[model samples]
Target: MWSFSTYKDKRYWILLITAIIILVLFAVFTPDYILEKTNFVPFSMLIFIVLFWSTYHLWKYFGDKKKRNNTDDSCDL
Candidate 1:
């Protein structure tokens, strides 16, 4: 149901992609000793927070656009 066409702005996508890349780099480059010491809880949580925040903003943008379209249609009648 979701499509990139629905959201014209690419900032959210960029944020999500950047977050994923950072996560991958962290996983690949972080020393084993550091990983073991923290169990990756904090880093993973930060990534999740970024992902959720971007997704929420995207969803809100879509909802607002849809609402504006509906209002415009009603006014045209």
Candidate 2:
């Protein structure tokens, strides 16, 4: 059976905490530098990570769509 387990999903919370910590650290210690280096390091990495995940999901979604379309076409024939 499928289920949601907090212990098994702890990484989600850990990632959230890590993101918060990184933001706080950047804000406190390197705000200007972060803003300046927005194209290179931490900020860019965050953006790239999000975009990469989004692209993966977009690819998966389109794959599902194509599969559904093929199934429907075959059924119609």
Candidate 3:
């Protein structure tokens, strides 16, 4: 059975995608004043946190996947 946690799950993907889109849109579409008026510093911080979380989960996900593959390979030996 597979269990979902704060990391390496749908939540992680959603946050990662959402943050990327937001950053892209912010840089391309939104104007500088909009961010300044809306408090871009805090918003950027939040996005960075999400990015960090996504990075952590991505590493963990790949690491666990590698471990599982190795174990499976060993079982075939």
lDDT (CA) per prediction: 0.75, 0.64, 0.75
Q: Write model 1 residue lDDT over 1-77, tens digit each, in one string.
A: 67876366565677668777977897899788877866576877777797767776877788789989999899873
Question: Which candidate do you rate higher for lDDT, 2 or 3?
Answer: 3
Any idea what lDDT model 1 has? 0.75
- Largest lDDT belongs to which candidate? 1
Q: Tell me the TM-score of each prediction against the true structure.
A: 0.47, 0.48, 0.50
Q: Show where candidate 1 strays beyond 4 Å.
A: 1-39
Candidate ordering by lDDT (highest first): 1, 3, 2
**Top-TM-score structure, candidate number:** 3
Write the residue-wise lDDT of candidate 3 on 34-76 in tens digits. 7777677687778788777777677778978998999999988
Q: Residue 48's C-alpha lDDT in candidate 2?
A: 52
Poorest stretch of ten by lDDT in candidate 1: 5-14
What lDDT score goes with residue 69 in model 3? 93
Cα lDDT, model 2, residue 66: 93
Q: List the residue pairs that clash in candidate 1.
A: none
